[model samples]
Target: MACVTGKNSKPKSMSKAKEWTVEVENLFRFQQAGYRDELEYIQVKQGALIERWPDTGYVKKLQRRDDTFFYYSRKRECQDFEVHKVKVYAY
Candidate 1:
């Protein structure tokens, strides 16, 4: 829980931002699969990524062809990019 002050300088009850743990169910790496480039197949758990604005859902999977890769995310904006720990989640 987080405390937020309103315009009247009074404390308001508010719930903190929900934090989610992300896990990659399967990751396949193919060597020389692309045009002299490596290719990867990433499959994440369903409903792992949470969308806060505009929409709300989870990223199911990612598709890659040649040098172009299509990714689906729940978040509308990008703040910072980084990688964290990955755990296998049973669907």
Candidate 2:
């Protein structure tokens, strides 16, 4: 006979969270909050975060595993999720 698991099994770990989506605007917010990184910069004209291309310094550092990423302390439920919009001016 094969063993079966019960409903009271231990909760799954967050370790399976390998893929992450890094939003450029959030990085910009982090930078404004004093998190500095050459790869993370606010374009004077665009007012948007520069992730790669046209922004070589910071991108290079990111390639070397030297980038600074930020995260929220608490997890939110689907119903509690909110959408934030940022506007950037371009040349």
Candidate 3:
């Protein structure tokens, strides 16, 4: 819901989660050693947390690791589960 005016507009609590995403926006600022002569295929990395899940326990992060990529965190069921995101940039 974009906008809410009712009393129940918000939830009582939220859950932790890790989300991930991919994209290519900027390349001029992208500097790669392996792709110095080639163009940046696409970069990706950890991102931010939009919202928390109440049922599961997890955390979220959103960020741009490269000039043309982004990522998010996802909620893991296991407490010891390590969330790792990889970015593939083809030269």
Candidate 4:
């Protein structure tokens, strides 16, 4: 599946995440699944449900573009070094 940004508008601003928060962690998973963020994922997938850990609310699974699946752990998956790799997009 092609990555879609809705109307093709670019993010108003973007920055590398400095810390690992629940939002950042979810964004990391979304990016890994070829989406710019959760909003884009919902738009592209047409509101498909995203499975999450009930207690911690962390992302538990994601479906990739090729119709494959990616599973994440309940614990933090974005390591310290990898925090910089997660992008925060504003539109």
Candidate No. with top lDDT: 4
Estimate every model's Cα lDDT from 0 to 1.
0.25, 0.29, 0.26, 0.82
Error of 4 at 69 (Å): 0.8
Across 1-91, the per-residue lDDT of candidate 4 in tens digits comes to: 2244655556778889998888898898889889888777677777789999998898798888788999988988888889899989987
Better of 1 and 2 by TM-score: 2
Best by TM-score: 4
Q: What TM-score would you give candidate 2 relative to the actual structure?
A: 0.17
Task: Write the residue-wise lDDT of candidate 3 on 1-91 in tens digits.
Answer: 1232443233334222243321211111122212211121122222233233344322222233344332223433222232222222331
In what order do the candidates fall by TM-score, top score first?
4, 3, 2, 1
Better of 1 and 4 by TM-score: 4
lDDT by residue (tens digit), candidate 2, 1-91: 0122542233232121122223333333343444332222332222344344333222311222244553332222112122122222211
TM-score of every model? 0.17, 0.17, 0.18, 0.84
Residue 58 lDDT (model 4): 84
Give candidate 1's TM-score: 0.17
